[model samples]
Target: MGKVRGELRSHCPINFGIEIFGDRWTLLVLRDLLLQGKRRFGDFQASEEGISSNILAERLDRLTHYGLVTAERVAGDRRQIRYEPTEAGRALLPVLVEMAYWGARHDPRTAAPKSFALAYEADRAGLLRSVEAGTNPSEG
Candidate 1:
């Protein structure tokens, strides 16, 4: 496991993972980057969850601090910033995928598309690769 940004609660891996990204907003930010191809601050704000600017800023900072994401100046535009997932961030794809799967199976109101669930079951590895490549697997 990668190093967490702050002091750990315990040696338990689950606890550590939760400490890193236990908040509801943190995973949403990761979802935007991993699944929605959202790279800008505004894009995240535009998400359906209606996240506040303060919370978005806090999550992005924490993700960056934990080495899950990187924020860089967009080329030719100093004022514009692009957020990209680091390798460590990309590594969370499987976790996210499994969570989606579980939610689809257990939650009747889950928005996970049937096509995505089927495609994921058919080619889990390929789907992960597509996601890591910044493409939506269900779209293809």
Candidate 2:
């Protein structure tokens, strides 16, 4: 792998992409947005890895700025703002799914949940359906 040089903004497309989500927390925040339907600070705080409030706030802001996420106020709850994935963000689903499947397959200690393992075993179409069902509100 080539080393990143002085100014990141001038790097190639790959470097630019990594610059946005190169950190551990950024992808975790994206995972929460996709799998858990977490749209608020409190919800993210309650996730398994227990991200810090300050970090969560910063990630949300960055995600919003990158156009991967959009914030909207909950109807009838002016104080509650929800963060949701945009079309670009939703396009990352396949990448996340592939990563999960690869991890479950290669890592002996992963202990992936039964449903996830089952989905990994199925055909791509079936696996995508399962992922969609899990992500959609009515099924959740």
Candidate 2 C-alpha lDDT tens digits along 21-84: 7788888888888866788878888988888888888778877877889988899998988988
**Top model by lDDT, which number?**
1
Q: What is the lDDT of candidate 2?
A: 0.75
Q: Clash pairs of candidate 2?
A: none
Error of 1 at 76 (Å): 2.6
- lDDT for each residue of candidate 1 in 40-71, tens digit (9 for 90 to 100): 99999999999998889888988998899999
TM-score of each: 0.88, 0.80
- Alpha-carbon RMSD, each predicted model: 3.5, 5.6
